[model samples]
Target: MHEISVAAALMRRVLAEKEARKLERISQIVLQIGPMSGIMPDALQFAYDSLREGTQLEGTELVIHSAELTTCCRHCLHLFDSRLMHTRCPRCGSEELQIMGGDEFFIQYLVTEKV
Candidate 1:
């Protein structure tokens, strides 16, 4: 699955950071995932669990946080949550909309043991 590649990339970054800091082990990794990021948290965790074997992150915990979807109406200047999956403005019913968030996937922080 695509989550495997994503997990691999994430581990690469974490490993780089761990090396730079000379950390002995990672305890936790916090990730913020947007609703539209197209990543399943379960799959990500599974991928991480599989990939972390025998590595610095072997016993690391993967924590995921959800980011809300927001959109701005280009016609009415209204901003609102898009959890309803509506493509238009809820206030003015305008079809012109600009998505502001909910397509993000990034690592927020990590907890590690210093060497």
Candidate 2:
């Protein structure tokens, strides 16, 4: 699954940073996932749990937070949350909109124990 690959990449990144900083171990990983990022949180957690065996992040907790989808109204320049199937602007009722958020997938922070 793609989530396994994503988890592998994330682990690689965290391990590299841990080695560079001489960290002892990772305690937690905080992730920010956009609703439209196409990355499933449960799949990601499963993949990470499967891949972290015997690694520095073996028992690390994975915390995921979802970001809301946002859109900018082209006609009124108003930025607002855009729900699925409701793309119209709430302020101006315009259908013309440019997506501003909800396409992000990234590691926000890592809590680590000192070496």
lDDT values of the candidates? Answer: 0.88, 0.87
In candidate 1, what are the lDDT values of residues 1-115, reduced to their tens digit?
Answer: 6999999999999999988988887899999999889998889999999999998788899999988888899998998886557777879999998888788899999987766
**Compared with the true structure, what per-residue lDDT tens digits does model 2 show for residues 1-115?**
5999999999999888888988887899899998789898899999999899988688888889988887888999998775464668889999998887788899899898776
Clashing pairs in 2: none
Quote the lDDT for 114 in model 2: 71
User: Given candidate 1, what's the lDDT at residue 99?
Assistant: 82
Residue-level lDDT for 62 in candidate 2 = 87
Instruction: Give all candidate RMSDs, comma-separated.
Output: 2.1, 2.2
Candidate 1 at 84: error in angstroms? 5.4
**Candidate 2 wrong stretches, greater than 4 Å:** 83-85
**Collision pairs in model 1:** none
Scanning candidate 1 in windows of ten residues, the lowest lDDT window is 81-90
